[model samples]
Target: MIINCGPLTGFTQARYVIHMSTGKRLVLFRLPSIDPTSSKPNEKEGWSYYAMEAECPHAGGPMADSLIDIEDSAYVASCPWHAYDFNVETGESSVGIKACTYPIDVRGDNVMLEFPAEDGLNVALSKIEPVSEKVKLKNARPSETPTAKQEDSGMARYLDDDATLCDWAVHILNTAHPEHKIELTTHLFAIFTEREASSSPMEIGRGTVTAPDQPPREKMLTVNPGAMPRTGRGGTLKSRIAMLHALANIELWAIDLAIDICVRFATFQTEKSSEQLPRAYFHDWLKVASDEAKHFSLLRTRLEEMGSHFGALPVHHSLWLSAQETAYDLRARISIIALVHEARGLDVNPMTIQKFRLSGDAESVEALEVIHHDEITHVTTGHRWLTWICNQEGTDPVQVFRSNVQKHFRGPLRGPFNEEARLEAGMDKRYYEEMPNVVAAS
Candidate 1:
C-alpha cells in the first residue's frame, strides 16, 4: 500500500510538491494528524499531509494557487477554474466524478505514498512515432529567405463522413505506416466512447477494400514457413526477445485479420438490412480486434524491454495467407482463421509460458498468459458467430464448418490440440473429432 516517495520533499522547508511513480503529479498540503507509534525522520509524530492531483480536472487550472484549508473538514483541495471542490482523503469531486488523490505516509524519515510493489502498466513510449525533439530540430533549420512561413496543414479525417463509419475503419486497415497503431487505437477508443465510427450502415463503393500491407519496416524481410530461422529460446535473452517478437508479429496480423473480416463481411444478408449484417456481427469482430491490439502492444513492449523490437527480426507472413484464402466467405474466415489457426495458439501457449518461465522472463510470461486467455475467448466468439450463421442458413454448424475447412484450408489440420482450452472456448469435441475423419474420407 504505502510506497516510499522518498523523504517527503518541500516539507518543513519549502512549498511541497511530489510526483507519483505513475507520472501523476501531487501536492502535499496539510500535515498528517499525530500517530504516536510513528518513528519517521522528521518525527512529527501525529502529522500527515494532504495531497491532490496537481492539475484541476475542469481545465488544467492550478490547484496549488487556489488551495483551501478546511480546518479539519471533509473537503480539502478546491479548484478555482469552475469552483470545483474535492476531498483530499477520498478524491471525491464536489461536482461529479472523483478527483485523483493519494494516501500519504512517512516511514524511516522517507516520504512514501500508497503505490504498488510492481511497476504499473508500461505507459512507456513504444516509439511508433518520431520523438518531439526531432520535430523541434527540423523546425529550427535556417530559412534562405524571410518569406511567409508555411504552417503544417491539419490532418484530414480518414472517412470524412460519419455515415460511412465502416469505411473509416477500413481506412485504418489500409494505413501501412508504423503510426497506424496510434490511429487504430484512437479510432477504437472513439467507437467505444460513442464519439465517431458508428455502426450505422451506408452503401459503400462497388469494389471491396483490400487489407493494407503491415506497417512498412514491419512488412520487411518476409519468409515462408520453412524459411523461418529457428528462434532461440530457453536461457538466452536474445532468443527470448526474438521469440516474443515473432508472437507479437502474429498478433499484429490478427488485428488486421479481424478488421478485414468486419469490413469484408459487413454486407452479408440478414433479416435486418442489405448494407451489412446487424451490428452484432461486426461488433464481435471489433472485440477480437480490440484484444488483438492489447496483445500486440503487450508483447511489443515486452520485446522492447528485452532489447529487440517487433520488426527487428524476420517473420513469416503465414497468418495473412489464411486471410487471403477466406477473403470472400464468412464461414471459411471464422472456421479456418479463429477455430483452426487460433485454437492451435491456445494449445501451445501453456508450453510457451513454461518456456518463458524457464528463462526467468516473468514479464514475457505474463504477456503470453494474457494473450492465451484472450484467445480462448476470441475463439468462443468465433464459434458463437459461426453457429449463428449456420442457424441462419438452416445448415448443420459442424458439418458446414468441416466443409468450409476442406474447401478453404490447405493441407492437414495439425494439432496435439488444446482440447481443454478449445472446450472452454465453446468448441465441441465432435467438431474436431469428425474433422480429420471427414477430411480423410473426402
Candidate 2:
C-alpha cells in the first residue's frame, strides 16, 4: 500500500505501507502527519491530508496510537487519555464512550491516502509505490465477523463472579493490553459463532423477616417488583440489599461503554477543522465516569451493611442490548444510553430514594442522593455533546433524536420528566417544552 502524503512544511509526499499484525494491510503517509490544529480548507481528494485511525470523534482520544484490530467489528484500542475499549468496525465504544469509522481507499494490494497540502503550498500529484505481497492471497482472511465465543465466555466469567480479577480479565478480553494483545480473533469467532442460551434468573437465599405487626405505611414499604431480586422478599434484608448493589454494579458496565465513547472524541488526535471540537470537549465525560464509579461503590457498601453483596441477584441484559444495537453509530449510542437512560435516572433514582425514605431506609436514600446529584451532570454532558453534534452536522437535535430513538428502542418512556435535572443537563427548552404535546399525540 502507498500513501501520497501531501506537501507540508516539513514532510514530502511520500507513501508507506503498513502491515497490520492482524494480517490486514494498509498504507500510511510518509509526509508530515497531521498537526491536528490547522483548519482544513475544501480541497480535492488527492490534496487532502488526514489523521489515521488514532482519533475518536466522541472523546478525541488517540486510537491508532495504541490499538490492535482484533476482528471486523471488534478491536482493542487503548485510550491515551483513559484506558477504554473501542469496537472498531461497529464503533461500539466501551469504557470512555467514543470512536468513529474513518475513511480510507484500497486498490488491490496497494492503499493510498490523499492528504491536503499544508501552508498553502501547491504540489503536483505524487505517485505512491505499491509493496509486493509476500504471503499467498488464499491464506489471508478478511475480517467479516465478531468473535461470539470469546464474548460469551467473557460474559460468563463476568456473570459467575464479577470480582476485581474479573474486571481485569474483562479489560484484557476486550482490549489489547501488553500481554493479552494476542490475535485470537479467529479463535474467539470459532468459539462464539453459535448463539448461546441466555442466563437464567438466579436463586438467592431467602430468610423469613419476623417484624412486629407492621403499620399501614409499612405495607407500601415493600420492595419494588421492578428492582427486586429474582428471589422473593422472604429473602433476608441483607440478601435484598445485595440485589440492589448488584443492580448498581450492572449499571457501571453500561457506563463504562458510554464513557469510552465520550473520551474518544475529547482527546481526538487529528487536525481539527474550524467546525470540529477540541480536547476540552471531553472533560465532562471523565466527570460522568467518576460519578458512576462512586455510585457503584456506594451501592456496594450499602449492600454490605445489609450482609450481602453485588452479584447476589439476577440482572437483566437490556443495557447491553442497547449498546449492541447502536454499535455502529455514535449519535444513536449517546442519545439512547446517556440522554434516554441516564436522563431517566434523574427521575428513577429519586423515586427509588423516595421509596427507601418512606420505608425508613436511610442508607439507600443517601446512596441515591449521591447518584442523583452526579446524574444531573451526566445528563448535561449528553446534552452538550448531542447539541454540539447537531450544530456541526446542521441538523435538528430533537428531530434527529426522535428518529434515532424510534429506530433503536421499543419500550415506552415514563415521564413527568425531572425538568430541573434536564435544565441542568443542557437540554434545550424546546425539547422538554414540546414533549408533552408529542407524548400526548403519540
Candidate 3:
C-alpha cells in the first residue's frame, strides 16, 4: 500500500514510513519541510521533536514541496517552493544545485523519514511560508542554454527545415537537423508553388499549405512510395538491420528535443526559481532520449519486414512543428509535444498495434507497445512541467492550456484522446474530466 504525507509535512516516523512492495516507488513526500521543528514540542497538538533534514541548499532556506531524486540513487530531494536543491544523503548543502533535497531511508520494504517538529507559530507560519526565505532561493542563474555542439545532433537536423507549404509538412515530419529546419520549411513553400516535384532532397507531400497554422494540406499520406527496399540484403535479419538504422536516426532526433524541452526549458528555466534545473532532469531526459531512439529503431525494423523503409509513408511533421513553434516557450512546447501529441500517441499507438496484429505482425505490435508505455512517461513529464509553469505564473494551468491549444493547434483535439492515458500522464483531474468538452473540429 502507498502512504502519501501532507505536502508541507516533513518526516515524522509515524507520518512518513510506508510499506511498499518490492520494486515499488512511492511519492514519499511533497514539500520537504516548511514547518521545520527543532527540539520543539506541543502535547496539545500531539506531536513534536524534529528538525529539518537540511537547510535550503539554495540559500539555507527551508526545504519544502520537493521530491526525491530517485534517478541517481542519490539522497536528494527537489524543493518545490523554489526549486532549490539539497543533498539528503550527506545532509550537506546542495545549495549550488538550486533544488531542495530531503532525508529518507528505506529499510527492507518500508521507507522511513524523520519528521521535523513544528513550532507553536502554526497559524502565523502558514501565512508566512509562501513569502519566507524557505520559498526563495538566492542568486540562481538562468537555465543553461544548449551549447553549439548540441545544435548539430540528429534532432537538430530535423529542426533546420524551411517553412514552405508541401515541404512544410515534410520538414515537420523529417528527422533532419535543427538548423536545417527553417530551410526545409522554406523548401516546402517552393515545392508547393512549383507543383512539379523538384530534384529536391527527399521531400514527399502535396504542394500546398492549407491552414496558415495547421498541418499538411493533404492529411492522407500512407506507406507506399518509400516501400520496396533495395534487394540483395540479408534474410529476416535485414528488416531488423534496417529498423536499427532508422531507429538510431530517429532516436538521435527525438532525444535532442526531449533534452532541450525537459531540462533546459522546463526544469531549469520554467520550474526553478534560481534558474538551475535539477541535474536529475538531465539524466532523465537523456535516458528518455535513448529510449525513444530504441523505439524508432524497433519500429523501423518492423516496417522493413513489409518491404517498406522509414521514409516510405509520409509521416505528419506536426509533432516537431509544435516543438519548433514553442521552441522559445518551454510551457507551450511541452503542452504541444509532450501533452497533446504524446497523449494522442497513447490513443493512436493501440490502433497501430492492432493493425500490425491483424496483419499477423506481432513483432511490430511489440515495438509499438514499447513506444506506447514510454510515451506515457514522456507525457507525464510534459504534465509536470506544464503544471510547474502554470504555478510559477500563478495562472490556472488548465485555463492557460486551453487558450494555448486554441492559439497553436489547427485540427480540433479529437477525443478518443486516450482519457485513461491522460490520467496516468498526470493531466489534472478537471482537464481529464472536461476533455470531451474541448471539442476539436470534425
Candidate 4:
C-alpha cells in the first residue's frame, strides 16, 4: 500500500504522524541533508527522508514529538519521555533497540510511504484532525490517558475540548479582579506544564482568538503618566508602600501583556506565515505570564504587610498604551515592551534594591532582587523570539529592532543604562547604544 502524505512543502512540521487503517501508526520525517549537494552515485542529491513507528521502543513515548538534531553527521530524534536517541535513517538507538523502518520515496514534490499489502491503511494526515481526537499509538505499556476520577478533579476544567490554551488566555485577560486573575493565571500555567510533561499534552488551538482592546479592570484609578502621584524615595514607610504598589500595578499589566501576545499573534505559528513558530513559543510566553503573576502576588503581599494594597494608589495607562500601539505587530511589541520598558526595569532595579536596603526593608530588597533576576530572563525570551523571526526573514536583527522601535515609540531613548543586564539578555550595543535621539542621564 502506498500513501501520498502531501507535497514536500506542506510538511511545515518536520515530523507528521500518519494513522493506518489497521490501527498501526507511522511518523514521517523531512530531515535536513548533512550534505545537500552531494550523494552516492545514482542516488538522489538530497537524501533526507524517513518513516518509522510512532512509539518509542523503550516506553511508548511519542516519537513523532521527538527532538530532532544532528549527531556525527546523521539525523537523530530523541524521545521526549526518556531522551532515547534513535538514528532517523537506520532506526538504531543507543540502548541496543532497533525500531522498525520503512521505505519512503519522493515522486516529484509528493512524499510517498510504502507498506506491505497486508497492513491496509486509510489516507488521512493526523495534522488535519482535531488534537483531542488524534489516535493514541503506544506500546504495550499502560496508557497514560487520564482516568475518569482524575478527569473530575480541578484540572478537568482545562482538559475539555473547548477550553484550549488560547481560550484560557482570553479568559485571563477578561478577568477583572486582581486576585482572581492571579488564581486563573496560576491554574492555567500549572495545567499546561503538567500536561506537557505527561503523555497527553495540552492543545494550543488555532490562533484566531481576538484579545480585548484593553484588559478588564475595576476600582483602580487610571490617569495620565504626568498626573499619577509620585512615589518618593524609599526612606519612609509611606514612600516604600507607594513604590511597592506601583511595581504591583506594572506586574499586573505585565501578566496581561504576556498572555495577550500568546493569543493575539498566535496565527504566526501557522504554516501560512513564512516564519512559523512552534508550540514552544506558546510555552515560553505562558511561562512569562506565570512569572509576572508571581511578581504581582509578592508585591501585593508586601503591601498588605505594611497596611497598604495594590489598588490603594492610582497608576498611569502608559504601559497598556504601548500595548495598543503595537497590537498588530509582534516585532514592535517585543521591541518596545520587552527590550525597552522591561529592560529599563533591569537598569533601575539595583537602585531600587539599594534604597530598600538602606531603609532596613530586607524583605522588599529580597523581593526586588528576585524580580530583577527573572526580568533578565523575560527580556532574553523576547530577544530570542525576535532574532528567530528576523532570521526567518533573512534580515539583520539590529536593523529590524531599531526600525520597529523608531516606528512605534514616541519618546527619546534614555541612558544611565544597566549595560551588564542588557548584555546578559542578548541585547548588544549595536541595537541601542547609538540611537538617533538618545537622552544621556542627568
Task: Assess each prediction's global lDDT (C-alpha) against the native.
Answer: 0.62, 0.46, 0.44, 0.75
| Model 4 segments more than 4 A misplaced | 1-162, 269-273, 438-442
- The sequence of per-residue lDDT tens digits that candidate 2 reaches over residues 1-442 is 2243333332233323333333323333332212324433312223332234444454444343332323332234444333355654334565546554334443332233443334655544333322221111122223353323445423211122222222222332354221121222122222221111113221211111111111111111234347655542313465346447555645455445444454333322222333544323433443354445456656766766777655555455456656667665667877888888787777667666665676677777766776676666566667766767777777787887776766776655557788766765656455534332232112
> Model 4 clash tally?
1
TM-score per candidate, chains pooled = 0.60, 0.45, 0.45, 0.64
Structure candidate 1, residue pairs in collision: 5-112, 7-111, 31-48, 32-47, 32-48, 32-49, 33-46, 34-46, 35-46, 41-109
Model 2 error, position 399 (Å): 1.7
After superposition, which runs of candidate 2 have C-alpha atoms over 4 Å from their true positions? 1-243, 263-277, 428-442
Task: For model 1, state the Cα shift of residue 134 in Å.
Answer: 27
Model 4, 49-99: lDDT tens digits are 788888888767667656565667777786644457898778998889988
By lDDT, is 3 or 4 better? 4
lDDT for position 50 in model 2: 26
Is candidate 1 or 4 superior in lDDT? 4
Q: Identify the runs in model 3 with alpha carbons over 4 angstroms from their true place.
A: 1-253, 262-275, 312-316, 432-442
TM-score of 2: 0.45
Better of 1 and 4 by TM-score: 4
Question: How much does candidate 3 score in TM-score?
Answer: 0.45
Output the lDDT of residue 279, model 2: 27
> lDDT per residue, candidate 1, 1-442, as tens digits?
5555444443552124555545766666644443447664433545656566778777665565333434243435655334467776777775787777766665656665664435654322111111010011112213332122324222223444333435655676765543344345345533542321223534443235544544233356787989888876556887787788788778877877887776677667633323346555655566677667777777767766777776788888788878877777888889999888888898889988999898788887877877886777678778877877776777787887788877877666666788878876667676676455334222
